[model samples]
Target chain A: MDVDIDKIPKHLLRFEYPIFEFNKAIIDATHQYVVAYKPNMAFYEANGLKGWKSLEKTIKYLNKNYPEVFTIADAKRGDIGNTSSMYAKAFLKDLDFDSITVAPYMGKDSVEPFLNFEDKFTILLALTSNEGAFDFQTLSTQDSPLYKKVLETSKTWNYAHRLMYVVGATKAEYFKEIRSIVPNNFLLVPGVGAQGGSLQEVCKYGLNKDIGLLINSSRGIIYASSESDFSEKAAVEAKKLQLEMKQILENHF
Target chain B: MDVDIDKIPKHLLRFEYPIFEFNKAIIDATHQYVVAYKPNMAFYEANGLKGWKSLEKTIKYLNKNYPEVFTIADAKRGDIGNTSSMYAKAFLKDLDFDSITVAPYMGKDSVEPFLNFEDKFTILLALTSNEGAFDFQTLSTQDSPLYKKVLETSKTWNYAHRLMYVVGATKAEYFKEIRSIVPNNFLLVPGVGAQGGSLQEVCKYGLNKDIGLLINSSRGIIYASSESDFSEKAAVEAKKLQLEMKQILENHF
Candidate 1:
């Protein structure tokens, strides 16, 4: 779910909503191999009102045409209690997304409102896949690193079962430790391809009996090409990753 | 700059864009007392595309009519490197806001992109005015709390001068400790009116020779009344706060 006016195929410019058209092409081509479509909100938001409309169309298309596929609004949002409720309602109820990414910087009250929605999931940032991730996330608390405390403390909240952690693919070594804290909960792992994180490394320690991992690849798949066959190229990239995951599952199971 | 369809005057609903119309009335009434208008993104986003349009109108109204006043897109947005850059461009460049609030859970790389803008400010969340703030912010690190570390570490980043912090007015006791670390940088202090924080307490320790403190009162002022004269009532609330602040400044000076 990454589209930029400059980066999208020039041919798409003729459409009323090029971003939505590009997304529809990619979704139509790759829906069979993918279980979830995580649209990074920043990309759509950068375009303003048009960007927002494109996002609304993309989500509606998925919900209507491909109900089986999960939808994640990669809008990293969290705030005070009432404010968080508004965000929860916006993303989960209004947008009708299955889940939305959230930052845990504001703590429990900021996050719990999102958990109130029955089937909706809240993906909390634990250990992000970026160089700056080490800044505060990895800071040593009294006994353990801050990320560990986040994983440990969040488990005690209401509707904890609906909580999923965003454990970056870039930090595969931290998977074993993260799994110990959040063994059963699903993990949304980003940074697989473009960020140089090994898919095998993430699967080795990330997989559980439920196959609890939603490995995400943004730039690697969606931006695979910018030509007329952009969606086909995206599908090929998605298929390759899907095949790798299948192989890894066979070896694990 | 908070406007809600349910909370605004019933008569405003007759307008095409009630939220924007309501905001315009409030700004028209209270602009003299205010130096900045901070619109919480959740309210606008909850209404979808129409909500977004209202937000664009509200900001445009402020930029055009009250150019002397600062505009803040209170969108607590932060993501991985490139994604953060997209957000920075959205709020700071595309929306033409003077500043945007950011959550720092992802750390320096997530925040630096927002700071990259020449004159636009980045208000990083440090100690938010909420009960959940205690969850991670107050955690004891090796020597100082996580928030102090946030204040201490963030100062070392590029364009640190462009950085201000969201230090909740709820915990006025922490202001002295916070001032010691970042003495000169302005602190956008929320939780003043509705959340019950003392303007006197915040000004005592949080003030610098530059008088660097932006005290915020949201619900107490904006929702002052839901009747026909809602904006007039809101002006009264805003005036009261301004008077209190004026007295504090007089005594401090």
Candidate 2:
């Protein structure tokens, strides 16, 4: 099992409240524990235009201030070819994140455009945690789960090596089965913390030799405390997770 | 059947584009022939902070200037509950789009979040044109195709009455089958112009009693003329389609 997303980008795009102070406190508190940070696009987007601007500032600040940390645009974007290229230009070129999460529904062409950049990565949706997941991803076709097929077919791509998959942390058990097919690719696991996924279980099945896991706990960490100490609380929560992850990694490696 | 979505906000949440020129040209040219304008979120999003702002401007301009036109934020966004709420707020609340293209792999809670909005609409991915669409969407579950079940189960939601589905124009034959199940609900048809889908055939089986179809031609219209005459050429192309659609509507109605 590998970490979901191996190479994080420079910009951490999300809605960190109280902006500068919030990020500073969080960064100060738990910089050592976290390898990367992801700011969900909707959080900043909900705040309206000014919120979007703040997202930009947040990415720039972290890239300039803390180069050690990897940043991801937690934007699940995918589209047709020419439009996809435009998206590549937008997220990869203009905003300059290390990787962007994408939906794989449009097949390889839609996904490949994003994989063109040498350093950039593409995180494809695999087995998601939500109920609708049962509606399609888990459905069996040709004697295997659809997600298994998604993983298998994705490997056919030359740039599939640059691909990381999004496996909802809540569905950790599937990681063992998912690993049989997609052994080397990174997995970006969310749905931990506030979403109630078991981090221990995820590690049991999802970790690769490379320690390649990016488990995200958004609301649980970011909104840990609404007051001035919010980022500090976020740091505490992150530290706790990281500490546990370190033990898991040590035991396995 | 009905053109959904409310209005775009005044705030600059997305990227800025040459909205007036580009949109006006598309509107003027295709105003009579086309039924909808589907701008994939990635396009606006590619501009980073500026992209979302432009998305807002683009949506607002469409809603205000051309009430007859239908708009879609081809956001292909679907996630767990809390996150889906934020997505709904971002696209439907913050910006006005007639419909949002949602991925149905996540199940009810993920999709229902979008359905809660009145007048606003949700277009679930039933069958897409991509090659890998075969990997999951068409997979046989027991006896039914996954896309078939998606169309069936989505009906369980009361708000689903407001739901439309995405049936790729490329899969035009599926439209005949999809129409049998969802005879009344609208279908948001994409892949017509440049993704190698045909419009005449798509309309043959896809249209319903209300002309329940929103056929989108993005690159075919927007990038019609990359030169200064791009917008003018776009208008000419759009008008050609709209005129054809007008005849279709007249004959069908």
Candidate 3:
């Protein structure tokens, strides 16, 4: 969903609440430059259920406002089969999001339920931005970090074509290594801007031929200005990233 | 909350809204055994915004009807400082949960905001029940898995005395391993019966003299019967676990 910054209500500015203001403003300023909007569900959820209500309203507003924009719920959810089915029902059925971010730690049964949906996508947590990313994600079992094995194993899930991955911008250094493993699939890049991630380095290796990157800039854009001009500043910040992304898309196209 | 399992409202019996019914019934049965009832915030959330409302009601119900039960919003939340403050507002102010579960992955700044609450507890995710647990939890970084460092570091937080740890039921093998590290703190354990975790094993290694284990049996007890008999069965299941716990406490005292 392209969250047009100008369309947001002023009272909704919050870091905890990754509001439609961020999504709308960013989309208003940059949707033409990018293919998807990945609103990390945690950002809105951290605001309590009210923030979630805002998110639902935001997504509905987007569907009505920008039918062309793809909606990705950056939820990072994955669980046992029955649980995943319920999750899929929650986000895909009730919320009507186009995609969801998932954690593939529980293997097939946990992730497959999300994949069962026809067009909705599941972006699995591959390599994160934190220092602890090195803890379990990069730990070597047979010569490859466990993240690689996750990518390799994920390929076997039948309905996995709708799958994508989360490769943090902070780990842009490993994008080249990651792309070599799963070259064709889309990647949702987070940890850009306010998180100290370099957009230039991330595009260099993470971008696939489809201009395949949904780079999420949460705090940097949404919480750009805590004051009344927050939405406008978010547009400015989003435009900056979009301009850089436009050049990256040009090279591939 | 008094998880009103004994006489569940008819609508929620078919695992339709299991957390609601299960929580209610369990509370009715085990409120005496626990000072706190922590339904993993993730479980309710996995159901999306509507599920979030149920959580709100659950917390409200506990505060209204069973005020003695300290409600823990088990979100396993940990983020940057300002973000953490907003989260504090989300749960403490918005949801009004008496406690919360935090992730200690980030360090002091990530956990401190939650600890600032005088009445609220922040139960850190120290040791989990998942198989991937060995991937990081047991890593010999300087001394032990990051969990040990969490337990030690948390000791210095001003209200860290209110802190707890999520030690899994399956990790009872590390009973002696854990006892040596933390002798007094409460452990919120999942992975009982339904998850192939043994109650005997968990108590063997995990029970402190204070009966410091809020061992949650969600699926096993709640889903024990899909019919209207669910609550009755849930009460039966909870009583069985509580009885065993009573014996364990008897031996300890």
Candidate 4:
């Protein structure tokens, strides 16, 4: 689940507390139903240093309370080799995220440093849920689509085992073709609820032997209601997805 | 110039001081020979909250002491519509950067929020100087290259006047083709000096009526020496580039 802090509902904001308070409520309510907590860095960063403090607190809260839940920094960060190393340290080392989202635009050297970390994962943006995914991701060469090229080329890099790719749930039809290219790797699927993607349709083509999928629902679960029952509403929304996921696991396994 | 803070020499590191102290000396030494200072955010963020504090201090130092010099937050950030708006605030509003480098992979909504700011510039990644540039940037359709498509499509976005493009110094030959597409916009050219790109070649094909180029040399200038004379050495390097730029301006103008 991606926690976009700014999108917290009005009832939650009425407490006149820091953003972490809202995050705490959400985590307390929904942690049982989630395998991971993914927080997009931009939302916290937008508020400046104060925002970062909240992010640090939120991550600490997750680690201290729910040690079993994996934490992801959905920063979408990548640069050159040395620079990428710095980002790797920032998220994987300093912030203690299990994984960080990266853009594949810069290629091999840009991503290599992130993979160098021992146990940490690097999730490359394969096919995003937004309209912009059509811009360069779907563009074709003489051989294959650009997204396919990303998968093929990245597999050749060092520490390829730590690699995962993001495939939007909205692009469920492409999952069959995507699975043909990367059959073993996990796919972090976004856009299931708010973006109108069907969980059932995504699972039909995306599942692998490892039951590889981390379906994220941000706005749908985190911003479920604007009233005082926001956390309860969020829990209900997450439970619905969790139950669906449990059913899918049983069917596939 | 993109200041990758970790690249500062061993001599400067001997001080056992905060990173901003080294940056202060570098800026004091080289400010006269430069028009702008671009700090790559990953370098600072990698060190965690303390590193970000150094970044905040560095930017404040530049703005306080040298108001004439433009500052670019070379953080290649972009996301969906609402998320991008947060990044715009993080860099342009909270951090007070004069400009920011953005990735065009997400298309309009991801970039439009950055451009929405008045008087701030948004430099889109068109052609980067790294090996990863070949991964997706060069993929061509029947009409033009993906980078070209980015230039054409982004030109139609809101606040297009605030836009610029990153044309790597390594791809001097492509500048001719790129300039034809975006003739008037400034190009932030990296890969000069230490990256083995010829400043002369880039200016030959990239310059416009405004001498529209910000040729960046990061390692070549900042890590010019590993002794106490580091600041003076950096000044010498920056002066050399400035003189060459002046000669290029004289010949072209």
Native contact recovery (fnat) for each candidate is: 0.91, 0.62, 0.13, 0.69
* lDDT winner between candidates 1 and 3: 1
Q: Positional deviation of A182 in candidate 4, in angstroms? A: 0.8
Task: State the displacement of the C-alpha of residue B22, model 1, in Å, after optimal TM-score superposition.
Answer: 0.5
TM-score (C-alpha, index-matched) for candidate 4? 0.94
Local accuracy by lDDT, each model: 0.94, 0.74, 0.70, 0.86
Query: What residue pairs are clashing in model 1?
Result: none
Model 2: per-residue Cα lDDT over B101-137, one tens digit each: 8887767888888999899899988888766577567
Q: Which stretches of candidate 1 lie over 4 Å from their true place?
A: none
TM-score winner:
1
Write down the worst ten-residue block by lDDT for model 4 chain A.
A1-10
Highest lDDT scorer = 1
Off by over 4 Å in 3: A1-30, A46-49, A78-81, A104-112, A130-160, A223-236, B1-26, B33-35, B40-43, B46-50, B76-85, B102-119, B124-127, B130-163, B223-233
The Cα RMSD across the true interface for model 3 is 5.0
Q: What DockQ was computed for model 3?
A: 0.23
Give the per-residue lDDT digits (tens) of candidate 2, residues A10-99. 133243434443555566677787887776776667666766776777677778888778778776776666667777876677777788
Off by over 4 Å in 4: A1-17, B1-17
iRMS per model, in Å, is: 0.6, 2.1, 5.0, 1.3
Ranking by DockQ: 1, 4, 2, 3
Chain A TM-scores, one per candidate? 0.99, 0.88, 0.86, 0.95
Worst-scoring 10-residue span by lDDT in model 1 chain B: B1-10
Task: Give the candidates in order of TM-score, highest first.
Answer: 1, 4, 2, 3
- In terms of lDDT, model 1 sits at 0.94
